[model samples]
Target: MNTESLLRDLREELDDGGLRGSFLVRDLHTGQEIGLDADLEFPSASLVKVPLAAATLERIRRGELDGATQLEVEPGRVTTAGPAGLARFRHPARVAIDDLLYLSVAVSDGTAADALFELTPPAEVTRMLREWGIDGVSVRHATAELADTPAERFEPGEVHLAHALAIRAGTAGRGHPVSQLDVSRASAGSARAYVALLEALWRPSEVDAEVAARTRDLMAHNLLRQRLTPDFGSDATKWSSKTGTLLNLRHEVGVAEHADGQVFAVAALTESRVPAAIQPEAEILMARVARTMRDHLRSR
Candidate 1:
Protein backbone atom coordinates (compact mmCIF):
# COMPACT_ATOMS: atom_id res chain seq x y z
CA MET A 1 0.00 0.00 0.00
CA ASN A 2 1.22 3.53 -0.74
CA THR A 3 1.04 4.93 2.79
CA GLU A 4 2.20 8.38 1.74
CA SER A 5 -0.58 8.81 -0.78
CA LEU A 6 -3.08 7.29 1.68
CA LEU A 7 -2.16 9.86 4.31
CA ARG A 8 -2.39 12.66 1.75
CA ASP A 9 -5.84 11.49 0.78
CA LEU A 10 -6.81 11.22 4.43
CA ARG A 11 -5.71 14.79 4.99
CA GLU A 12 -7.92 15.94 2.16
CA GLU A 13 -10.85 13.95 3.54
CA LEU A 14 -10.41 15.50 6.99
CA ASP A 15 -9.94 18.99 5.56
CA ASP A 16 -13.19 18.66 3.71
CA GLY A 17 -14.98 17.97 6.96
CA GLY A 18 -13.16 20.74 8.86
CA LEU A 19 -11.81 18.19 11.35
CA ARG A 20 -8.40 18.11 13.00
CA GLY A 21 -6.78 15.09 14.67
CA SER A 22 -4.15 12.33 14.75
CA PHE A 23 -4.17 8.64 13.92
CA LEU A 24 -1.83 5.60 13.86
CA VAL A 25 -2.65 2.28 12.23
CA ARG A 26 -0.33 -0.71 12.22
CA ASP A 27 -0.61 -4.10 10.63
CA LEU A 28 0.66 -5.84 13.76
CA HIS A 29 1.38 -9.10 12.02
CA THR A 30 3.36 -7.44 9.22
CA GLY A 31 4.81 -4.42 11.05
CA GLN A 32 3.46 -2.06 8.37
CA GLU A 33 2.31 1.30 9.78
CA ILE A 34 0.74 4.55 8.63
CA GLY A 35 -0.49 7.68 10.34
CA LEU A 36 -0.98 11.44 10.24
CA ASP A 37 0.11 13.55 13.22
CA ALA A 38 0.72 10.27 15.05
CA ASP A 39 3.23 11.87 17.41
CA LEU A 40 1.09 14.71 18.66
CA GLU A 41 -0.35 14.29 22.15
CA PHE A 42 -4.07 14.67 22.74
CA PRO A 43 -6.19 14.78 25.88
CA SER A 44 -6.83 11.22 26.99
CA ALA A 45 -10.43 11.78 27.97
CA SER A 46 -11.42 8.21 28.93
CA LEU A 47 -8.56 6.47 27.06
CA VAL A 48 -6.45 6.50 30.24
CA LYS A 49 -8.67 3.75 31.60
CA VAL A 50 -7.10 1.24 29.17
CA PRO A 51 -3.70 1.53 30.83
CA LEU A 52 -5.34 1.61 34.26
CA ALA A 53 -7.07 -1.67 33.48
CA ALA A 54 -3.80 -3.24 32.33
CA ALA A 55 -2.04 -2.13 35.49
CA THR A 56 -4.81 -3.41 37.73
CA LEU A 57 -4.86 -6.75 35.94
CA GLU A 58 -1.09 -7.11 36.23
CA ARG A 59 -1.24 -6.31 39.95
CA ILE A 60 -3.80 -9.04 40.36
CA ARG A 61 -1.41 -11.47 38.68
CA ARG A 62 1.40 -10.47 41.09
CA GLY A 63 -0.87 -10.94 44.09
CA GLU A 64 -0.88 -7.20 44.68
CA LEU A 65 -4.66 -7.08 44.09
CA ASP A 66 -7.53 -9.46 43.79
CA GLY A 67 -9.97 -9.56 40.91
CA ALA A 68 -12.63 -11.10 43.09
CA THR A 69 -12.30 -8.43 45.76
CA GLN A 70 -15.42 -6.36 46.25
CA LEU A 71 -15.77 -2.67 47.10
CA GLU A 72 -18.73 -0.46 47.74
CA VAL A 73 -19.92 1.99 45.03
CA GLU A 74 -20.04 5.28 46.86
CA PRO A 75 -22.14 8.08 45.36
CA GLY A 76 -19.16 10.39 45.33
CA ARG A 77 -17.42 8.20 42.74
CA VAL A 78 -20.22 8.37 40.18
CA THR A 79 -20.15 10.63 37.12
CA THR A 80 -22.51 11.37 34.22
CA ALA A 81 -19.97 10.46 31.55
CA GLY A 82 -20.94 6.81 31.17
CA PRO A 83 -23.75 4.33 31.48
CA ALA A 84 -26.07 3.97 34.46
CA GLY A 85 -24.37 0.81 35.71
CA LEU A 86 -23.29 1.98 39.15
CA ALA A 87 -24.89 5.39 39.02
CA ARG A 88 -28.40 3.96 38.92
CA PHE A 89 -27.98 2.12 42.19
CA ARG A 90 -30.10 3.61 44.98
CA HIS A 91 -27.94 2.14 47.75
CA PRO A 92 -24.25 1.57 48.18
CA ALA A 93 -23.54 -1.67 46.36
CA ARG A 94 -20.45 -3.81 46.68
CA VAL A 95 -18.92 -4.82 43.36
CA ALA A 96 -16.09 -7.17 42.52
CA ILE A 97 -12.77 -5.84 41.28
CA ASP A 98 -13.21 -7.94 38.16
CA ASP A 99 -16.54 -6.27 37.48
CA LEU A 100 -15.01 -2.87 38.13
CA LEU A 101 -12.34 -3.54 35.50
CA TYR A 102 -15.03 -4.48 33.00
CA LEU A 103 -17.08 -1.43 33.85
CA SER A 104 -14.08 0.88 33.59
CA VAL A 105 -12.67 -0.37 30.29
CA ALA A 106 -15.59 -1.92 28.39
CA VAL A 107 -18.24 0.57 29.38
CA SER A 108 -16.07 3.66 29.98
CA ASP A 109 -17.84 4.01 33.30
CA GLY A 110 -16.31 7.01 35.07
CA THR A 111 -17.52 5.93 38.50
CA ALA A 112 -15.92 2.50 38.21
CA ALA A 113 -12.76 4.04 36.74
CA ASP A 114 -12.46 6.50 39.64
CA ALA A 115 -13.03 3.64 42.08
CA LEU A 116 -10.08 1.75 40.60
CA PHE A 117 -7.94 4.88 40.84
CA GLU A 118 -8.11 4.57 44.62
CA LEU A 119 -6.46 1.15 44.28
CA THR A 120 -3.99 1.87 41.47
CA PRO A 121 -3.15 5.55 41.54
CA PRO A 122 -2.05 7.46 38.44
CA ALA A 123 1.55 7.32 39.69
CA GLU A 124 1.47 3.53 39.78
CA VAL A 125 -0.09 3.38 36.33
CA THR A 126 2.71 5.60 35.02
CA ARG A 127 5.34 3.34 36.60
CA MET A 128 3.76 0.30 35.00
CA LEU A 129 3.91 1.87 31.49
CA ARG A 130 7.53 2.96 31.89
CA GLU A 131 8.53 -0.43 33.26
CA TRP A 132 6.89 -2.01 30.24
CA GLY A 133 9.05 0.23 27.99
CA ILE A 134 6.12 2.21 26.64
CA ASP A 135 7.09 5.81 25.80
CA GLY A 136 5.45 9.00 24.49
CA VAL A 137 2.57 8.42 26.88
CA SER A 138 1.78 10.22 30.09
CA VAL A 139 -0.80 9.11 32.65
CA ARG A 140 -1.08 11.93 35.13
CA HIS A 141 -4.46 12.40 36.81
CA ALA A 142 -7.45 10.37 37.82
CA THR A 143 -10.77 10.37 35.95
CA ALA A 144 -12.22 12.13 38.96
CA GLU A 145 -9.63 14.85 38.52
CA LEU A 146 -10.76 15.05 34.89
CA ALA A 147 -14.34 15.38 36.12
CA ASP A 148 -13.49 18.00 38.73
CA THR A 149 -10.90 19.91 36.65
CA PRO A 150 -13.44 22.38 35.29
CA ALA A 151 -14.54 23.25 38.79
CA GLU A 152 -11.00 23.93 39.94
CA ARG A 153 -10.50 27.43 38.46
CA PHE A 154 -13.68 28.15 36.50
CA GLU A 155 -17.06 27.01 37.58
CA PRO A 156 -20.79 27.27 37.96
CA GLY A 157 -20.99 23.55 37.73
CA GLU A 158 -20.13 21.26 34.82
CA VAL A 159 -21.07 23.49 31.92
CA HIS A 160 -20.33 20.74 29.40
CA LEU A 161 -21.28 22.68 26.23
CA ALA A 162 -19.86 26.06 27.23
CA HIS A 163 -16.54 24.52 28.20
CA ALA A 164 -16.55 22.35 25.08
CA LEU A 165 -17.18 25.30 22.81
CA ALA A 166 -14.42 27.28 24.49
CA ILE A 167 -11.99 24.41 24.23
CA ARG A 168 -12.92 23.74 20.61
CA ALA A 169 -12.20 27.37 19.91
CA GLY A 170 -8.75 26.87 21.50
CA THR A 171 -9.40 29.45 24.19
CA ALA A 172 -10.34 27.42 27.25
CA GLY A 173 -7.50 25.00 28.05
CA ARG A 174 -4.37 26.76 26.80
CA GLY A 175 -2.04 28.39 29.31
CA HIS A 176 -2.01 30.31 32.65
CA PRO A 177 -5.03 28.91 34.45
CA VAL A 178 -5.35 25.41 33.05
CA SER A 179 -8.77 24.18 31.97
CA GLN A 180 -9.94 20.57 31.93
CA LEU A 181 -9.69 20.50 28.15
CA ASP A 182 -5.98 21.37 28.17
CA VAL A 183 -3.92 18.54 26.69
CA SER A 184 -0.89 19.40 28.82
CA ARG A 185 -2.90 19.41 32.03
CA ALA A 186 -4.90 16.31 31.23
CA SER A 187 -3.86 12.65 30.85
CA ALA A 188 -2.41 12.38 27.34
CA GLY A 189 -0.58 10.18 24.82
CA SER A 190 0.25 10.13 21.16
CA ALA A 191 -1.33 7.84 18.61
CA ARG A 192 2.00 6.04 18.15
CA ALA A 193 2.38 5.47 21.89
CA TYR A 194 -1.11 4.03 22.11
CA VAL A 195 -0.45 1.68 19.17
CA ALA A 196 2.67 0.51 21.02
CA LEU A 197 0.64 -0.28 24.12
CA LEU A 198 -1.97 -2.04 22.00
CA GLU A 199 0.83 -4.10 20.51
CA ALA A 200 1.76 -5.23 24.02
CA LEU A 201 -1.82 -5.97 24.97
CA TRP A 202 -2.23 -8.25 21.96
CA ARG A 203 1.14 -10.01 22.19
CA PRO A 204 2.42 -10.08 25.76
CA SER A 205 6.03 -9.57 26.76
CA GLU A 206 6.31 -7.30 29.81
CA VAL A 207 2.96 -8.21 31.29
CA ASP A 208 1.95 -11.79 32.10
CA ALA A 209 0.40 -13.74 29.22
CA GLU A 210 -2.73 -14.49 31.18
CA VAL A 211 -3.05 -10.93 32.31
CA ALA A 212 -2.64 -9.63 28.77
CA ALA A 213 -5.15 -12.13 27.49
CA ARG A 214 -7.76 -11.02 29.99
CA THR A 215 -7.03 -7.39 29.32
CA ARG A 216 -7.49 -7.84 25.56
CA ASP A 217 -10.68 -9.76 26.19
CA LEU A 218 -12.10 -6.94 28.31
CA MET A 219 -11.16 -4.34 25.71
CA ALA A 220 -12.65 -6.50 22.94
CA HIS A 221 -15.94 -6.51 24.78
CA ASN A 222 -16.14 -2.71 24.91
CA LEU A 223 -19.90 -2.11 24.71
CA LEU A 224 -19.73 1.23 22.92
CA ARG A 225 -18.71 0.78 19.30
CA GLN A 226 -20.16 4.02 18.02
CA ARG A 227 -16.64 5.41 17.68
CA LEU A 228 -14.56 2.72 15.93
CA THR A 229 -16.87 -0.23 15.74
CA PRO A 230 -19.43 1.22 13.34
CA ASP A 231 -16.85 1.36 10.58
CA PHE A 232 -15.12 -2.02 10.82
CA GLY A 233 -17.65 -4.07 12.77
CA SER A 234 -18.86 -7.09 10.86
CA ASP A 235 -18.98 -10.88 11.11
CA ALA A 236 -15.71 -11.29 9.23
CA THR A 237 -13.94 -8.47 11.01
CA LYS A 238 -13.82 -7.93 14.77
CA TRP A 239 -13.39 -4.41 16.20
CA SER A 240 -12.70 -3.92 19.88
CA SER A 241 -11.74 -0.60 21.40
CA LYS A 242 -11.88 1.83 24.31
CA THR A 243 -13.40 5.25 23.49
CA GLY A 244 -12.57 8.63 25.01
CA THR A 245 -15.00 11.58 24.79
CA LEU A 246 -14.75 15.08 26.19
CA LEU A 247 -16.43 18.08 24.59
CA ASN A 248 -15.27 18.22 20.97
CA LEU A 249 -12.81 15.34 21.22
CA ARG A 250 -13.58 11.75 20.28
CA HIS A 251 -10.89 9.07 20.46
CA GLU A 252 -10.59 5.28 20.30
CA VAL A 253 -7.73 2.73 20.24
CA GLY A 254 -8.27 -0.90 19.37
CA VAL A 255 -7.26 -3.87 17.29
CA ALA A 256 -9.20 -5.02 14.23
CA GLU A 257 -8.77 -8.59 13.07
CA HIS A 258 -9.85 -10.09 9.79
CA ALA A 259 -10.97 -13.67 9.39
CA ASP A 260 -7.86 -14.36 7.33
CA GLY A 261 -5.58 -13.99 10.39
CA GLN A 262 -4.47 -10.44 9.56
CA VAL A 263 -4.56 -8.09 12.53
CA PHE A 264 -4.24 -4.30 12.75
CA ALA A 265 -3.90 -1.98 15.71
CA VAL A 266 -5.39 1.49 15.18
CA ALA A 267 -5.67 4.64 17.29
CA ALA A 268 -7.79 7.48 15.91
CA LEU A 269 -7.92 10.62 18.11
CA THR A 270 -9.84 13.59 16.74
CA GLU A 271 -10.97 17.07 17.82
CA SER A 272 -13.74 18.56 15.70
CA ARG A 273 -14.32 22.08 14.50
CA VAL A 274 -18.03 21.62 15.06
CA PRO A 275 -19.00 23.98 17.88
CA ALA A 276 -22.09 22.15 19.04
CA ALA A 277 -22.09 20.90 22.62
CA ILE A 278 -23.07 17.53 21.11
CA GLN A 279 -21.34 17.03 17.77
CA PRO A 280 -22.18 13.73 16.12
CA GLU A 281 -19.96 14.70 13.19
CA ALA A 282 -16.86 14.30 15.34
CA GLU A 283 -17.90 10.78 16.23
CA ILE A 284 -18.68 9.99 12.59
CA LEU A 285 -15.30 11.27 11.46
CA MET A 286 -13.50 9.02 13.92
CA ALA A 287 -15.18 5.96 12.41
CA ARG A 288 -14.61 7.23 8.89
CA VAL A 289 -10.88 7.63 9.50
CA ALA A 290 -10.65 4.21 11.10
CA ARG A 291 -12.38 2.68 8.10
CA THR A 292 -10.03 4.49 5.73
CA MET A 293 -7.00 3.16 7.57
CA ARG A 294 -8.52 -0.29 7.85
CA ASP A 295 -9.24 -0.47 4.15
CA HIS A 296 -5.74 0.67 3.33
CA LEU A 297 -4.15 -1.88 5.63
CA ARG A 298 -6.35 -4.72 4.42
CA SER A 299 -5.70 -3.96 0.77
CA ARG A 300 -2.07 -4.79 1.28
Candidate 2:
Protein backbone atom coordinates (compact mmCIF):
# COMPACT_ATOMS: atom_id res chain seq x y z
CA MET A 1 0.00 0.00 0.00
CA ASN A 2 1.03 3.59 -0.53
CA THR A 3 2.19 5.78 2.38
CA GLU A 4 -0.89 8.00 2.40
CA SER A 5 -3.38 5.13 2.39
CA LEU A 6 -1.35 3.28 5.04
CA LEU A 7 -1.23 6.30 7.35
CA ARG A 8 -4.95 6.96 6.89
CA ASP A 9 -5.79 3.36 7.71
CA LEU A 10 -3.46 3.31 10.70
CA ARG A 11 -4.91 6.54 12.04
CA GLU A 12 -8.40 5.06 11.72
CA GLU A 13 -7.26 1.91 13.47
CA LEU A 14 -5.81 3.88 16.39
CA ASP A 15 -9.05 5.89 16.66
CA ASP A 16 -11.09 2.71 16.60
CA GLY A 17 -8.86 1.37 19.34
CA GLY A 18 -9.52 4.55 21.38
CA LEU A 19 -5.86 5.67 21.18
CA ARG A 20 -4.21 8.83 19.94
CA GLY A 21 -0.45 8.86 19.62
CA SER A 22 2.81 10.00 18.12
CA PHE A 23 4.62 7.12 16.38
CA LEU A 24 7.74 6.96 14.23
CA VAL A 25 9.84 4.25 12.62
CA ARG A 26 13.08 5.13 10.89
CA ASP A 27 15.75 3.21 8.99
CA LEU A 28 19.00 4.08 10.76
CA HIS A 29 21.06 3.53 7.63
CA THR A 30 18.94 5.30 5.02
CA GLY A 31 17.18 7.81 7.26
CA GLN A 32 13.79 7.10 5.59
CA GLU A 33 10.89 7.08 8.03
CA ILE A 34 7.14 6.90 8.58
CA GLY A 35 4.81 8.05 11.38
CA LEU A 36 1.57 9.55 12.72
CA ASP A 37 1.85 12.84 14.64
CA ALA A 38 5.45 11.80 15.28
CA ASP A 39 6.38 15.25 16.51
CA LEU A 40 3.56 15.67 19.00
CA GLU A 41 4.89 15.87 22.54
CA PHE A 42 3.46 14.01 25.54
CA PRO A 43 4.36 13.62 29.21
CA SER A 44 7.23 11.10 29.11
CA ALA A 45 6.56 9.22 32.35
CA SER A 46 9.41 6.74 32.99
CA LEU A 47 10.73 7.28 29.48
CA VAL A 48 12.76 10.07 30.99
CA LYS A 49 14.92 7.38 32.57
CA VAL A 50 16.67 6.68 29.27
CA PRO A 51 18.05 10.19 29.12
CA LEU A 52 18.74 10.00 32.82
CA ALA A 53 20.81 6.90 32.28
CA ALA A 54 22.61 8.51 29.39
CA ALA A 55 23.43 11.64 31.39
CA THR A 56 24.53 9.62 34.39
CA LEU A 57 26.80 7.42 32.32
CA GLU A 58 28.26 10.48 30.63
CA ARG A 59 29.09 11.90 34.04
CA ILE A 60 30.79 8.66 35.03
CA ARG A 61 32.82 8.78 31.81
CA ARG A 62 33.95 12.28 32.68
CA GLY A 63 35.15 11.03 36.11
CA GLU A 64 32.74 13.38 37.86
CA LEU A 65 30.76 10.43 39.22
CA ASP A 66 32.05 6.95 39.88
CA GLY A 67 29.89 4.02 38.79
CA ALA A 68 31.27 1.98 41.69
CA THR A 69 30.12 4.53 44.27
CA GLN A 70 27.36 3.10 46.43
CA LEU A 71 24.52 5.13 47.92
CA GLU A 72 22.10 4.10 50.67
CA VAL A 73 18.49 3.84 49.49
CA GLU A 74 15.53 3.89 51.87
CA PRO A 75 12.51 1.73 51.24
CA GLY A 76 9.58 3.32 49.42
CA ARG A 77 6.24 3.88 51.09
CA VAL A 78 3.67 1.15 50.55
CA THR A 79 1.18 3.78 49.44
CA THR A 80 3.47 4.95 46.63
CA ALA A 81 3.73 1.52 45.10
CA GLY A 82 5.52 0.43 41.93
CA PRO A 83 5.50 -2.76 39.90
CA ALA A 84 9.13 -3.75 40.54
CA GLY A 85 12.73 -2.87 41.45
CA LEU A 86 13.89 -0.49 44.20
CA ALA A 87 10.45 1.05 44.70
CA ARG A 88 9.28 -2.14 46.38
CA PHE A 89 12.31 -2.45 48.63
CA ARG A 90 11.27 -3.26 52.20
CA HIS A 91 14.52 -2.17 53.80
CA PRO A 92 17.33 0.27 53.27
CA ALA A 93 20.19 -1.01 51.13
CA ARG A 94 23.31 0.40 49.63
CA VAL A 95 23.41 0.14 45.82
CA ALA A 96 26.15 1.16 43.44
CA ILE A 97 25.59 3.89 40.86
CA ASP A 98 25.97 1.34 38.06
CA ASP A 99 23.47 -1.06 39.61
CA LEU A 100 21.08 1.82 40.17
CA LEU A 101 21.23 2.53 36.41
CA TYR A 102 20.27 -1.05 35.76
CA LEU A 103 17.35 -0.90 38.21
CA SER A 104 16.21 2.44 36.84
CA VAL A 105 16.04 1.31 33.19
CA ALA A 106 15.64 -2.44 33.38
CA VAL A 107 13.05 -2.56 36.15
CA SER A 108 11.51 0.90 35.75
CA ASP A 109 12.49 1.56 39.34
CA GLY A 110 11.43 5.11 40.24
CA THR A 111 13.32 5.13 43.53
CA ALA A 112 16.57 4.15 41.85
CA ALA A 113 16.00 6.87 39.29
CA ASP A 114 15.42 9.43 42.01
CA ALA A 115 18.60 8.30 43.73
CA LEU A 116 20.50 8.94 40.51
CA PHE A 117 18.62 12.21 40.17
CA GLU A 118 19.99 13.28 43.54
CA LEU A 119 23.50 13.00 42.13
CA THR A 120 22.60 14.46 38.75
CA PRO A 121 19.62 16.78 39.10
CA PRO A 122 17.00 17.21 36.40
CA ALA A 123 18.49 20.49 35.20
CA GLU A 124 21.89 18.83 34.82
CA VAL A 125 20.39 15.98 32.80
CA THR A 126 18.85 18.50 30.41
CA ARG A 127 22.12 20.35 30.22
CA MET A 128 23.97 17.14 29.46
CA LEU A 129 21.52 16.29 26.68
CA ARG A 130 21.99 19.70 25.14
CA GLU A 131 25.73 19.29 25.40
CA TRP A 132 25.40 16.05 23.49
CA GLY A 133 23.22 17.77 20.86
CA ILE A 134 20.01 15.91 21.83
CA ASP A 135 16.89 18.02 21.88
CA GLY A 136 13.05 18.05 22.28
CA VAL A 137 13.19 15.86 25.44
CA SER A 138 13.29 17.87 28.65
CA VAL A 139 13.92 16.38 32.08
CA ARG A 140 12.40 18.73 34.64
CA HIS A 141 11.91 16.50 37.71
CA ALA A 142 12.75 13.19 39.29
CA THR A 143 10.72 9.99 38.94
CA ALA A 144 9.29 10.34 42.48
CA GLU A 145 7.16 13.24 41.27
CA LEU A 146 5.34 10.85 38.93
CA ALA A 147 3.96 8.83 41.83
CA ASP A 148 2.01 11.78 43.26
CA THR A 149 -0.81 11.73 40.69
CA PRO A 150 -4.51 11.67 41.45
CA ALA A 151 -4.38 7.91 40.93
CA GLU A 152 -2.66 7.70 44.30
CA ARG A 153 -5.45 9.66 45.92
CA PHE A 154 -8.13 7.28 44.65
CA GLU A 155 -8.82 3.81 46.02
CA PRO A 156 -7.23 1.04 44.02
CA GLY A 157 -10.63 -0.03 42.70
CA GLU A 158 -11.47 3.58 41.78
CA VAL A 159 -8.11 4.35 40.11
CA HIS A 160 -10.00 4.48 36.84
CA LEU A 161 -11.58 7.68 38.10
CA ALA A 162 -8.13 9.22 38.01
CA HIS A 163 -7.69 7.88 34.50
CA ALA A 164 -10.97 9.51 33.59
CA LEU A 165 -9.77 12.79 35.02
CA ALA A 166 -6.53 12.45 33.05
CA ILE A 167 -8.50 11.76 29.89
CA ARG A 168 -10.72 14.83 30.30
CA ALA A 169 -8.55 17.47 31.93
CA GLY A 170 -5.98 18.14 29.23
CA THR A 171 -5.89 21.38 27.23
CA ALA A 172 -5.34 21.51 23.48
CA GLY A 173 -2.07 23.20 24.29
CA ARG A 174 -1.00 20.11 26.27
CA GLY A 175 -1.61 21.57 29.72
CA HIS A 176 -3.13 19.32 32.38
CA PRO A 177 -4.68 19.97 35.79
CA VAL A 178 -2.55 17.08 36.97
CA SER A 179 0.96 18.42 36.75
CA GLN A 180 2.42 15.02 35.98
CA LEU A 181 0.32 14.68 32.85
CA ASP A 182 1.00 18.15 31.61
CA VAL A 183 3.71 18.30 28.94
CA SER A 184 4.72 21.77 30.05
CA ARG A 185 5.24 20.68 33.64
CA ALA A 186 6.22 17.03 33.28
CA SER A 187 9.12 15.29 31.58
CA ALA A 188 8.09 15.47 27.93
CA GLY A 189 9.18 14.29 24.48
CA SER A 190 7.74 13.42 21.08
CA ALA A 191 8.11 10.20 19.12
CA ARG A 192 10.44 11.92 16.69
CA ALA A 193 12.52 13.28 19.52
CA TYR A 194 12.78 9.88 21.14
CA VAL A 195 13.59 8.24 17.84
CA ALA A 196 16.41 10.74 17.50
CA LEU A 197 17.60 9.63 20.93
CA LEU A 198 17.47 5.98 19.90
CA GLU A 199 19.39 6.82 16.79
CA ALA A 200 21.99 8.58 18.88
CA LEU A 201 22.33 5.53 21.08
CA TRP A 202 22.38 3.02 18.26
CA ARG A 203 24.64 5.07 16.01
CA PRO A 204 26.39 7.69 18.08
CA SER A 205 27.15 11.16 16.75
CA GLU A 206 27.61 13.89 19.32
CA VAL A 207 26.85 11.53 22.22
CA ASP A 208 29.81 9.75 23.78
CA ALA A 209 30.25 6.26 22.33
CA GLU A 210 30.83 4.61 25.70
CA VAL A 211 27.83 6.31 27.25
CA ALA A 212 25.60 5.29 24.33
CA ALA A 213 26.90 1.73 24.51
CA ARG A 214 26.15 1.53 28.25
CA THR A 215 22.67 2.99 27.79
CA ARG A 216 21.95 0.52 24.99
CA ASP A 217 23.14 -2.36 27.16
CA LEU A 218 20.79 -1.28 29.96
CA MET A 219 17.81 -1.12 27.59
CA ALA A 220 18.67 -4.52 26.13
CA HIS A 221 18.07 -5.89 29.61
CA ASN A 222 14.76 -4.08 30.09
CA LEU A 223 12.26 -6.40 31.79
CA LEU A 224 9.13 -4.43 30.96
CA ARG A 225 8.38 -6.29 27.76
CA GLN A 226 4.59 -6.08 27.64
CA ARG A 227 4.44 -3.08 25.37
CA LEU A 228 6.32 -3.14 22.03
CA THR A 229 8.42 -6.19 22.73
CA PRO A 230 5.89 -8.75 21.55
CA ASP A 231 5.89 -7.19 18.12
CA PHE A 232 9.57 -6.32 17.88
CA GLY A 233 11.43 -9.16 19.58
CA SER A 234 12.20 -12.52 17.99
CA ASP A 235 14.88 -15.16 17.53
CA ALA A 236 16.21 -13.18 14.58
CA THR A 237 15.90 -9.73 16.12
CA LYS A 238 16.88 -7.83 19.25
CA TRP A 239 14.60 -5.18 20.67
CA SER A 240 16.14 -2.80 23.18
CA SER A 241 13.48 -0.59 24.73
CA LYS A 242 12.13 1.56 27.57
CA THR A 243 8.44 2.00 28.43
CA GLY A 244 6.73 5.07 29.89
CA THR A 245 3.31 5.11 31.48
CA LEU A 246 1.19 7.66 33.30
CA LEU A 247 -2.57 7.75 33.78
CA ASN A 248 -4.13 7.51 30.31
CA LEU A 249 -0.69 7.45 28.65
CA ARG A 250 1.52 4.59 27.41
CA HIS A 251 4.75 4.83 25.46
CA GLU A 252 7.80 2.87 24.34
CA VAL A 253 10.94 3.79 22.41
CA GLY A 254 13.62 1.43 21.18
CA VAL A 255 15.89 0.13 18.48
CA ALA A 256 15.11 -3.09 16.64
CA GLU A 257 18.05 -4.90 15.09
CA HIS A 258 17.40 -7.70 12.66
CA ALA A 259 19.77 -10.56 11.83
CA ASP A 260 20.24 -9.21 8.32
CA GLY A 261 22.19 -6.14 9.46
CA GLN A 262 19.07 -3.97 9.29
CA VAL A 263 18.36 -1.50 12.09
CA PHE A 264 15.38 0.72 12.85
CA ALA A 265 14.46 3.09 15.62
CA VAL A 266 10.82 3.04 16.79
CA ALA A 267 8.98 5.32 19.16
CA ALA A 268 5.32 5.18 20.12
CA LEU A 269 3.85 7.69 22.52
CA THR A 270 0.14 7.27 23.18
CA GLU A 271 -2.80 8.38 25.30
CA SER A 272 -5.95 6.33 25.78
CA ARG A 273 -9.43 7.83 25.68
CA VAL A 274 -10.70 4.91 27.72
CA PRO A 275 -10.61 5.35 31.49
CA ALA A 276 -9.24 2.07 32.74
CA ALA A 277 -5.98 1.47 34.57
CA ILE A 278 -5.10 -1.84 32.91
CA GLN A 279 -5.88 -2.04 29.20
CA PRO A 280 -4.32 -5.10 27.65
CA GLU A 281 -6.00 -4.39 24.36
CA ALA A 282 -4.48 -0.92 24.36
CA GLU A 283 -1.06 -2.49 24.75
CA ILE A 284 -1.79 -4.85 21.87
CA LEU A 285 -2.97 -1.97 19.71
CA MET A 286 0.20 0.00 20.44
CA ALA A 287 2.39 -2.92 19.45
CA ARG A 288 0.43 -3.59 16.29
CA VAL A 289 0.55 0.04 15.21
CA ALA A 290 4.29 0.31 15.85
CA ARG A 291 4.99 -2.97 14.10
CA THR A 292 2.94 -1.86 11.14
CA MET A 293 5.05 1.28 10.84
CA ARG A 294 8.25 -0.77 11.13
CA ASP A 295 7.00 -3.26 8.53
CA HIS A 296 6.18 -0.43 6.17
CA LEU A 297 9.57 1.19 6.56
CA ARG A 298 11.34 -2.10 6.03
CA SER A 299 9.33 -2.98 2.95
CA ARG A 300 10.40 0.29 1.38
Best prediction by TM-score: 2
* Tens-digit per-residue lDDT, 1-300, candidate 1: 478887888888887776777898999888988788998778888999899998999899999998999998876433344344664455777899999999888878777887899999988998999999887677888876655544334333545545555454564434313455666777888899899999998875787788888988998899987777878778998887888876666889999888989999999988776555466676787678878887787787
Model 1: lDDT to the true structure: 0.79
- In model 2, the runs with Cα more than 4 Å from the true position are 79-81
> For each candidate, C-alpha RMSD in Å?
3.0, 0.9
TM per model? 0.89, 0.98
lDDT of 2 at 10: 94
Worst 10 residues of 1 by lDDT: 171-180
How many clashing pairs does model 1 include? 0
In TM-score terms, candidate 2 sits at 0.98
Q: In model 1, which residue pairs have backbone atoms overlapping below 3 Å?
A: none
Candidate 2: Cα lDDT at 124:
95
